[model samples]
Target: MITSPIWLPATLMAGATQAWRTAVQRRVGKTLSINAAGLVRYLYGIPFALILLGGYQLLFPAPFPVLGRLFLPFCLAGGLAQIIATNLLIMAFGHRNFVVGTAYSKTEAVQGAILSFLLMGERLSTLTCAGIGCGVAGVMLLSTGGKRMGPMDFLRALGQPAAITGIASGFFFALTAIGIRRATQEVGGGDPIHAALIVLSVTVLLQTLLQGGYLALREPGEMRKVFTSWRVSGQVGFLSAMGSACWFTGFATAPVALVRIVGQIEVAFTMAFGHFYLGERMARSEAMGLMLVACGVVLALLGAL
Candidate 1:
């Protein structure tokens, strides 16, 4: 089995790559319909995922595992959930500021822990729980960009369209994480990385077919837009494939909750992207929040030790 130290790098890579993917997807969303933008990642990414699996097979040949019946269903569930989550996130982007919109979805770490325990029977330690709490609090603080949010303000924010969609996005994302983990387990092989890549390939294939079919049938014009905007969409697709490869590898190596908690660093990366790339300023509250998130990360690592 892979150790925590080995999985940590994969988790971090997943988070960092995903942050950039989200930014690219958000930009694509402005031009295409929400669903179409979400579809871009799956459609364009299918080729890259295939290439990854092919390259891996060539470099280190191994017999592929025969998947059980449950594998397809789990992969399908994860793919659909991710598609829904992505679309909902894009919808939230329409309703809130970018950083705040992304922050709302960071609720996934907590929800993922609960779902992992219930659905997969993975248990987390008390220290891990504390880390999740700290990380989530830090994310919330950053969400406000240093604005002092009182109880009433917080309540009101929750009632907004963006917050509602954001929370829903998190829920589906939790499902996606669990479903993918389950799928990878079902694929069952000695090589964790190889199993992960195979699962990723299958999931990407399923998503591409599902999303592409829907777009072709209902929104043919949007399909044209997706192809026409390949330059940008290509970046979203490649990044999505790379990030998900790292994520699946992490899941194959570690407990789902631990991976998700560590994955919260994506919020910090996103915050930095907002400040540096988008010319947004981080307020004092956001800085505090980032610190809290850093503390959570340290504690999480300690707990693993």
Candidate 2:
């Protein structure tokens, strides 16, 4: 039987790997436009994803699983949403620092709960809902950059470009999560790892084509940059593909909301990356907000159990 413990570790690892990948991708952003930097995750990752998928299939030598009725639509929608979401996030990065920008995007867990409910008909229990509430509150806290804002100020801040892009990024990422989960289930109920790999391979391929085609026409020079910096881009691709594989496996086994809530650990990992590697520090309010985020993650996991 699949247990929370089994999938929980995958979610955590995905989060950690994703934080690193985003950091690398963000650096890549400095050289390219938001669209191109966002595209790097999929474009470079395609080769590595193909290699992993091919290796798995060769080792197993199993017949391909039948795709379900909803598979194509789900996979395509998820892939497209991810492309848009990534661009929005890179835009947020341009407006804010890395840690704060990531914290803004961390609103995905709550947004995931809502999207999972609406699209997948997944229902959250009272405890799970409460955990989501805590998480959303924490996201708001982090979004404020630790400033003590009254209601009017909070509402005003939400109207800002950075906040709008950040929230929009979260909403679309939630869609990606739901769509990917549905796609994973449609692949078959047998081996989740295999199912995840199939979905990941297909989705990454589609994203590569979509983004690559766009860049080819609109930003050829940036496309050249993506290739010229293969050393760092390769690391980003490897980490992104592996992290996404873990996330897809977790989605296949767990509820999307639960998986996303658990994925909140990414914020902490991002903070650590910021502090140690980037020499960045958070304000007291930011620290307190992150603490709330930690509490929400713990509560959500306990509720899941």
Candidate 3:
């Protein structure tokens, strides 16, 4: 079956964000005012989301449901959870390491798979279960390092305020996936893609508002960042909205089994970008982990088996 052109765009978007920030750093080298690029990245994400919502509405018109308002609770909870998880991730990422965040986040696939089965009656094959196991093994292998950390050391990392927070946030993200799927069922009937878009729109909008509130308390006067830095911010918003839209659109068009299988290419995309853009050298263990993630994704997407 055809998988959507899902992972490639997402990889590009991820790379673009990194490249944009790196460019900003070079231009402002040693001037040291604000992390102009980073701020712009978050700020412009708002409008990107709005434009995405509008486009979705135009492309797929379904009435705002009057009868299915009950699902709003699920949507809201999921949204709140995503917001919390994301902010926690940002906190850790801001200080500790992006690789840590990325590696740890692989856990979400298992969480998502389990939740999908529980909440949506989407059955998991034995092979898929094995795929999930391999994914976990790969993540663990990727995360481990005798030089930097061992299993206990890794557990200690999780104990970090940010890491624990990430766990909590991941729970929310997982719940959001399931809850959104449920909400999608209510709003989208059986249309998976339609349901995914509706859920994403609702969740992203709510989360964006929450992000605004955080800015109010944290920065208080950061609105200028979005305005003055629209070039950088706009680029950010454009790429983010585009990637998300593609994921949702692809989800709507294909079987989720295939969609998620192709989605695993994101791991490869991350590795490739890191190699070329960030000058990141891959460790032997890292390569093994990446291979595992790739294998697991392929197995998860197995059409014949």
Candidate 4:
């Protein structure tokens, strides 16, 4: 199971694409409507899942009984909490000063690795542990810009509220990965396959309802925009769905800690896509940073794959 690197990288790539797409919406001065975004986040699975779900479903139509029943609620809470974290990121993006906050979030791999060990009984080999450490340093380096600041500088720049919110948001995403994996295990009673599908669907449903409710109350009229212009917003929605689905599948099949750590490949995906499609350029320092990040990923993959 650990040798399967395909879905893990795919999930990372999707994350990059999602961030880039979200940045596009920011450029248009009309971010994705909350409801539309929610739908995208939940139903995004539909585009890819549309064809695959049928086959995946046929593979595992039976229930896991206790497995599916136990982790369902945790999965539900995770889905809803994701919306809250999204809201925070959207707000931070609007503030235009969340660069550091975003970088701070890259440390989520560490958090997930630790939690995976503690809660899921996942153990890492020395190589894997070193790989994870390199991964942390590499991502932190990739996120850091030259001569900007040191440890104290970073600490001083982020106020308590921004720091708290960013850390909380990062933790929520890490937790989401763990929760999905936990749910999948529960669904493993009769058939792990069916359990995975049920967990994904249930999480999606809960996420949609919660996000939809919030949009109805607060951004009541913005729903019209989602349909009015389909290109940008639609892309974001679709990508969101694809990313979540990929992540769900990866978590279902592998150890949570491994999946989360290897998932850092998203940064590279974003950089590559940004260069080709968006004309974003990286300095030599930035490129070197990416190389280190890549090395970390390679290390993680060696142990994992």
TM-score, every prediction? 0.96, 0.95, 0.72, 0.80
- State the TM-score for model 4: 0.80
Model 2 lDDT tens row, 213-238:
99989999988888887888888889
Which scores greater on lDDT, model 2 or model 3?
Answer: 2
lDDT of each: 0.87, 0.85, 0.54, 0.62
Estimate, for each residue in 115-204, the C-alpha lDDT of model 1 and write its tens digit. 988887888778988999999888777767578999889778788898899989989999998888888888756677888899899998
Cα error, candidate 2, residue 9 (Å): 0.9
Give candidate 4 misplaced runs (Cα > 4 Å).
1-29, 32-39, 43-51, 58-67, 95-103, 158-166, 189-194
TM-score of 1: 0.96
Clashes of each: 0, 0, 2, 2
Sorted by TM-score (best first), the order is 1, 2, 4, 3
Of the two candidates 1 and 2, the one with more favorable TM-score, higher being better, is 1
Q: Rank the candidates by lDDT, best first.
A: 1, 2, 4, 3
Worst 10 residues of 4 by lDDT: 92-101
Q: Write the per-residue lDDT of candidate 4 for residues 213-232, one digit (tens) a residue.
A: 66667876765554565666
Tell me how candidate 3 scores on lDDT: 0.54
Off by over 4 Å in 3: 1-43, 46-67, 145-166, 188-195, 249-262, 303-305
Q: Name the lDDT value of residue 52 in candidate 3.
A: 60
User: What C-alpha lDDT, on a 0 to 100 scale, does residue 172 get in candidate 3?
Assistant: 57
**lDDT (tens digit, per residue) of candidate 3 on 165-219:** 5455445556655555455556644444445556666656665566666665676
